[model samples]
Target: MTDPQNWAAPGANQPGAPYPPQGTPPPGAPQNPGYQNPGYQQPGSPYPGGQYPGAQYPGAQYPGAPGGPGTPPGPGAVAPKPGVIPLRPLGVGEILDGAIAYIRANPVATLGLAAIVVTITQLVEVPLGIFALGQLAGLTAAPGDPADPTAIAGVLVGSVAGSAVGALVSFVAITVLSGMLIAVLSQAVLGHKMSIGAAWAAVRSRIPGLVGLTLLIALLLVLVAGVGVVPLVVLAVMQANAAVVVLVGVLFVLLSWAVALFLGVSWALAAPAYVLEGVGVTAAMRRSFQLVRKQWWRVFGISLLGGIIAVIIGAILSLPFSFAADPMSDPIAGVSIVGLLITSVGTIVATTVTAPFSAGITGLLYFDQRIRREGLDIELARTAQQG
Candidate 1:
């Protein structure tokens, strides 16, 4: 057979025999619109007439672009280095870790402030401890003497007074220290390092406010205890039925204790607010209550956890000293000056270490709550970047 290319139509084999004229348009057909040509351009051919996908046509910004006007950042797009915490809503573990990190990152500020306050607390406590021991020595009745209720009462009063004084002093000291550490932690969260002097200077003006808040809390607790105990005391003195008085007292104490604990957690962030926001005690209390409103249980749990941890560690540190001092025995007989001093040393060490951690946890928890309730992480991120 002939090759296909060499073959021709029967009519076309004759020269130009009625073949279709080159490039002739078919009858009644419109001229070619040139739509199929590669170089042809149409209206809005590059983009749709209305808008382009993912484009902000005139002055609009691309969604989620950093630092773009009218654009919000994408989720987790602004994460910076861990200064004190990852600037986001935090888990319980993260909060705890952040507290530890605060200590590690600014030991001179956190630990040094703790040590100074704890040392002052120890100084106040040691003298009281000695005075209490002396008072106990006098309260010991001679072997033949009947139990002297008056002398016994004197000893009880002395012990209680000594404890109250020591507690008050420690409260003031810790309040001051916590305010300073909070200032430090706030700066740390913004990726700034603060010297001890700087931290103190930042918080110095707020110390009086912190003290006032501390006193208010203490007074509330005392009132709660008094309300729970006064009825029982009255009934006992009036020779009421012992079982009745005990039962009523137990119920009252339990209820009051629960209320006190709830109130305590509600106001736990007051110090941070007072120091950081430069607010008054009443305003700080209100601010803390507002922050903790919907997250009361969470705040309570974290505060209780921190308190338990501090107590456990303090007990562990004091265990050896407790054994040496034998405080359970007669204060006059078993306790020695050296043993008392050693016990104080244990307390000082424990307080020095745990105080900062507890304070830091509170401050960070405040920040975490703010980040969740308000978009504080954005402000913090901006602050971090600026710094």
Candidate 2:
């Protein structure tokens, strides 16, 4: 009879070895003891098996199970990308592409979202104009003699009171509408349809912060105007652009343009940051400043692209209206009540269509930053699982 040790064993390194000697297992011998015969052991070796913790048993996989630790199912299958905006960090053009994709993916929702914002803005503008008109009327209707201090006081009081009341009323309405509109558009762009009430529910709690920031921004603009406009106008009257060019020339235009662009881009991202981050005005401004500081080119490119589109659409939409308003006035015709109403309506329609596309693009850009810097996708996954 053949020797027991010399009997051919499955997975043995040598054809005739039933088991390898002490401190050695055959090169292809079973790695786990239980899977091999129970008596399988090497003398003086306390540990019989070398399997690691959490390691799966051989030939024990359920049919169609995802094989191996941390491996997703199927050949060539990749795990899903986490987070709502799953696109990779985007450059300016890619962000615009994402925006266009959003519009294409949800045309009706995008339109509705944009409409809501545009309607509120345009409607508020109308009432604001009416209020301004009333203030102007009150100013004109003053009965007090110009020479009397008492009369001047009365006129000043009426003007001030009207101005304050008008501003307060208009601002409150716009603020409430803006918050509600943002919440709706945010969800809408994500392909979720929310009722007006639901959208309001999401944003009304943050209304005060939004309003305060709006007021602060308005104040900032007012301050900037006081510093820049009066001096610029005075200089312009004192010397024309060509004369200034002769003196400071191209430098003046360059400085003015640079300042304008810096301010414009700074303010551009501020509102979105406020709405999305729920940050206070100052914090939002700082955040925006930090984001755009090193990304000047990206910001400028996106802004230019959006601005060009807006200008082209504006020209197309306004041409007929401009002609309809009588194009031959020497001083140029004042705002026509009817024409203004029609134009405002058109603007609202256009805005409703475009706003979500822009908002989604902006929101996605914010997501990309957080994802790259904070492992935001992991947090988002946890949030989704919890939900």
Candidate 3:
């Protein structure tokens, strides 16, 4: 924090700096860090749930020193420690550690908000689950001895419709909450703090775009799956030759998978972009792609690692609750309301903890990417100084 007046945003005078600057680094910023924080923490998938929501999210807050980024910490030289993380490009351990630190640093905004959202999401799921399962169990054969196709179809349709509605509800609720959390992290990184109401207010206008971004990524994935499976399904229905079927299936699978992976990794930061950059869904996607395209593997690896940790931690934390719910949660035996409610409680406890951590890791990853690729530390420092 010494001699603040002379320090200039790195590359400020360079012809190609992202922004023009006349002064040195801001007073006390990590520089910039913290990305989107996916609010969901589901199972069987790494992202949104397993993605950043459940799978992975980015990192978090705290502040740094007032002086410039201090001699630009050389390789592992320990950059300015104004916040939860170092200002320079982050390492694998730093990213993970920062996530945990952030939760502790901003419990009310991070943990408190997460608990509220997960509680609501779980409570909502209980009724929807019972209704859907009940519809399936209620179907009986028509007047005829044989089962009625129409009745069966009706039940299936109803179940799908119900599930879709529930998903939409949970998605919107968690996505908004996650966005609010990111807003919290954005300030926290600058050594700032925010209340739950303040966090909500910061992100209120971006709700629509956040929801849209989630849906578009989902739609793209579904389309990729269809491309890989539709023809295989058709061949099976037609009783096509086994050899030809296998070959086509393998080729299609590989092609679709490649495309999906490219897009998925490239757009890993889209949620963060939407929240932080105030961009549309498509624009956010492009922003993430540009940010991630160069270090695709690194981004993918960090996200993968974050998702893995969240799953392991969530499983450990949730087990006791799951065991408690086991007696009442046996749906195969019957839709026991007690069991369903108990199960929901377990989910709430587990996700409440893991969701923010997941989001924080990915959000931090986003900050790391920007710092490395765009020298965002300078901009973040400036922002901090102004604030």
Report every candidate's CA lDDT: 0.69, 0.49, 0.67
Worst-scoring 10-residue span by lDDT in model 2: 14-23
* Deviation from truth (RMSD, Å), model 2: 19.5
The worst-scoring run of ten residues by lDDT in candidate 3 lies at 53-62
Scored by TM-score, the top model is 3
RMSD of 3: 11.2
Number of clashing pairs per prediction, in order: 0, 3, 37
Model 2 clashing residue pairs (backbone): 114-352, 115-352, 245-249
**How far does residue 46 in candidate 2 sit from its true spot (Å)?**
50
In candidate 1, what are the lDDT values of residues 1-387, reduced to their tens digit? 122112111122222111121122223434443211011111333634312123122222222336673333444344444377876667788788888888899988888778887888899899988888877676564666677898779878988999999988988888888888887777777666778877776767667777988899879977876688887888899999999999988988888888887788888888877766655678778878888999999998988898888888888877887787675556444576677888888887788789888987899888877666544554455445544
lDDT of 2 by residue, 242-310 (tens): 665355634554565567567656665565556655566777677666556666666667767766665
Task: Name the runs in model 2 displaced over 4 angstroms.
Answer: 1-85, 91-93, 100-110, 113-117, 120-193, 218-260, 263-267, 317-337, 381-387
Show model 3 residue runs off by greater than 4 Å: 1-77, 133-154, 233-239, 329-335, 385-387
TM-score result, candidate 1: 0.72
Tens digits of per-residue lDDT for model 3, 1-387: 122112322222222212212222233423433322221122433432122311111222212422232222222223344457765567899899988887889999898999999888777778888886666555532334566789778877887887788788888887887787776666666666678887776677777878888888988987986698877888989999999889998888888988898888898888876777656678778878878977999998999999999999899987887777677643443546666677778788888888888888778887787766555554554455445
Which candidate would rank higher by TM-score, 1 or 2? Answer: 1
